[model samples]
Target: MAKQSSNRATQVIEAVGSFLRRCIGSILSAGPIPKHIAFIMDGNRRYAKKQNLEEGAGHRFGYSTLMNMLKYCYELDVKYVTIYAFSIENFKRRPEEVQSTMQLIQEKIEGLIEKESIVNRYGVRVHFIGNLKLLSKPVQLAAERAMNATWHNSKAVLSICIAYTSTDEIVNAVEESCKEKQKGNEKLLDEIGEGPLIDVADVEKHMYMAVAPDPDIIIRTSGETRLSNFLLWQSARSLLYSPGVLWPEIGFWHLVRAVLDFQKNYAYTEKKSKES
Candidate 1:
């Protein structure tokens, strides 16, 4: 009887919360909404230590928070969402820790393609953005499968950056662009004494993030102000928002606050973007 009452109360609370969110979302919809938002999900280990849980448990909790954030972003009609899931530098962590994280990532990535998962629920097309060759064979296969599975959905896009860093992405893009230009004319530059200059367009076209527009807002949790090599090339004119809460503890209100802040400074952001 006690358990039944608790369940009833929980259901009531959830219903009320859902209604409140809808009301808030509608009000916010009246103003400018970002077309793309990027997240540097930080502080999983710190959160786990604070809560007296295993480090891996923090990542698990963080993944749950990520799913909730995705639902909220899609509900707000944001067309593109990007997450800094793993960085190239992260591979240098302790061997056991890296293995654990890889295992967890593999499991969750596989789950994302399920019929009832959020990717399908919102018609989000998934793209794994980064140096995918650095990933293990199983992980690479899983990522390829996810992308293939969601190839038909067109409502929105979810870009997951794994084994990614801004410097590496830039170098790879430049190299690929050069290679394309040099193809079938390997001696054109030598013979003509000049070659076409590689412009911003050329580099950008070859970027892993070329599928999505530049992010309007970049949010880094755990009160971090640094970009941490997440999207240096793409964030030249993006608004940066940092909330004090850790990744796992980030809630709906934090997202609301970020969006509100973005709206408040829309004019300034727009002007800066234009000037860029």
Candidate 2:
């Protein structure tokens, strides 16, 4: 009798929690929603240490958290979602760790090719933005295949920054733009006829993330306070949000808080963006 009573209470609590979540989601449905949301998923290793689990297992759990967050963002009508999946500097880590991370990423990328993968389920067009040549051939192939497979989806976009850094992206953009100019005009001079040579727009045009608008909110987890070279140029008017929760511990309520915060600051962000 006692066990049955406890189970009944558990059911009631779960039902109440679900109702509250739905109610909150409905309330915010009418408010301003951020079009682009970027995440710097941190603290996988720390979470693993705290939980007494293996390092790789923490990252796997983090991946699941990311997917759940993506679903919440999509439900709220967010059009673009970008994640700092891997940085170019990450290669400097120990060989075993780097290889493990790469393998995990590669597996997830290839998984998107499955018929009922999350990419298809959410109609998300995946963009693996970064220095692709720096990745292994198999990883490159998987990334390419994932992008191609999801190219037809237009409802949403999921841009993963794999093997990427803002500095590398900027340098590549400038080099590519200069090369294009020289090829077309057959001259090494920086100036074009009507323009003052390479300017901000020119560099931005060649940027890896040019396809998507700048992120309205840049979120860093695990209480990190720095941008860490992620989306440096595109974050001029973005509202920075840092919740003390680790990546694997992030929940819908955390996202709800972020959206609420964005609602309160939307006007200022808009005003600032216009001035810039």
Candidate 3:
């Protein structure tokens, strides 16, 4: 009887704590919110192991957390949200885990297509950036479908990076630029007499995110401090937020705090030429 009472008390306390956190987050300062926010969702496997749960369960919970975070961002009027869903290096993990993750991705994509989910309701355009050919046919098809479905959306954008590496992305952009240049002018190479002189603007025009602005803030959960080869071209001037919470454990309050911190630190300087 005493043990039962103790368990009930603990549940009540947890409920109270969650309510308070949400209330605090909602009431937090109205400040300058980032126009674009990128996230490195990390530590799903570690979270699973710690909870003695299956790896699949951990990933499922992580997806739920992502959904909640998206809603929070929408409420805050953030124009763009990008997430590192999978990396090119992650393909080396055990076959079973890799398969499981692929399955999860398929499920999430299919889910987005049905009914009026947040993505549909909010008119959030979806973009996938990566070596898409490396993914299975179904996954690729789903990604294309999602992008098409949300193509008309103007309110917000969501970019998912799967099978992606910063170096690969840069190289791909450069190759594209070279091809375009060759197409534009057959004799331009001789005219310039250049030894591989590529301008930053030329490369930027060929990148996957050429249509979108660079992220104002990049947040990585699970205490990871490094960029881990995500967004190499675009994050040169981004504000990074590394929080200790695991991806699945992150909540609205955490996001609120990150944005608040960003507001405190952000600076905007007018260019001298622009000033004149």
Please provide, for model 2 over 23-128, each residue's C-alpha lDDT reduced to its tens digit, 9 standing for 90 to 100.
Answer: 8778998888889999999999899999999779999999999988887888778899999999999999999999999999999888877988777888999999
lDDT tens per residue, model 1, 112-207: 999999999999999999999999999999999999999999999999999999999999999999888788987767865665557789999999
Predict model 2's lDDT versus the native.
Answer: 0.90
Against the true structure, whose TM-score is highest? 1
Residue 118 of candidate 3: its Cα lDDT? Answer: 81
Worst 10 residues of 1 by lDDT: 188-197
Consecutive 10-residue window with the lowest summed lDDT within model 2: 187-196
| Cα distance off (Å), candidate 2, residue 201 | 1.4
Per-prediction TM-score to the true structure, in the order listed: 0.95, 0.90, 0.86
- Per-candidate local distance difference test: 0.94, 0.90, 0.84
Which runs in model 1 stand beyond 4 Å of their true positions?
1-5, 190-196
Q: CA shift at 167, candidate 2, in angstroms? A: 0.5
List, residue by residue over 131-206, the lDDT tens digit for candidate 3: 8999999999999998888898889999999989989889999998888878868887887795664677889988
